[model samples]
Target: MSRDEIIDITNKFLVEEFEVDTEVVQAEANLKDSLDLDSLDYVDLVVIIESNFGIKLESKDFTDVNTFNDLYDLIGSKLHAIA
Candidate 1:
């Protein structure tokens, strides 16, 4: 999927699950810090991504994904590899 598509899906999930404003879920936003996402939320997010994108994201895969842009890159790469 394209970066814009990934961001749109991610932002939609965040809006529905976390009640976050889609406008605030920008590429530069920090997923953990800026969003204040807890561990369980992270797990749920991973599950959502896996189910929707068909990519198995291990905990280690998230080690370096601190920001939304980081996550976008990770998911984008996973989508590319799978395709």
Candidate 2:
């Protein structure tokens, strides 16, 4: 999928599944701070990524992911690797 599609899907999931405010979910928005996510929320995020993108993510995969853009790039890299 294209980056725009990835952004749309990720944004949709964050808004619907995580109850994140759509207004706060910008590309550069801080993932945890913007979404008010905790450690348990990370677990849910992992499951969401895997189920939605078919990308299995470990905690380490999130170590460098600070912003929604970071997460989007990470997902793109993982998807590229799979392809």
Candidate 3:
């Protein structure tokens, strides 16, 4: 998938699964802060990502993920690895 597609789908699920406003799901937005995700929310996020993107994301996978763009890159890399 292209970067645009990744961003599109990520935004969709973030809105649907997390109840985040679409406006808040910007590329530069801080993932945890923008989504208001805590520890349990992180677990739920892992599940949501796997279900939506078909990639299993471990907790450590998010160590360097700060913004939504970072997440898009992470997911894109994992998808590339699997492909």
Per residue, candidate 3 scores C-alpha lDDT tens digits across 1-83 of: 99899899889999998997899998998999999999999898889889888987888999999999999999999999899
TM-score per prediction, in order, is 0.90, 0.96, 0.95
**When superposed on Cα atoms, how far off is each prediction in RMSD?**
1.1, 0.7, 0.8
Off by over 4 Å in 3: none
Model 1, position 16, has a per-residue lDDT of 84
Clashes of each: 0, 0, 0
Worst 10 residues of 1 by lDDT: 20-29
- For candidate 3, the 10 contiguous residues with the lowest summed lDDT are 51-60
Ranking by TM-score: 2, 3, 1
Query: For model 1, how does the per-residue alpha-carbon lDDT over 1-83 read when each residue is reduced to its tens digit?
Result: 77899988877877788887777787887889767888998898899889878898999999999889999899999999889
Q: In candidate 3, which residue pairs clash?
A: none
If candidate 3 were superposed on the true structure by all CA atoms, what would the RMSD be? 0.8
Winner by TM-score between candidate 3 and candidate 2: 2
- What does candidate 2 score in Cα RMSD to the true structure? 0.7
lDDT of each: 0.86, 0.92, 0.91
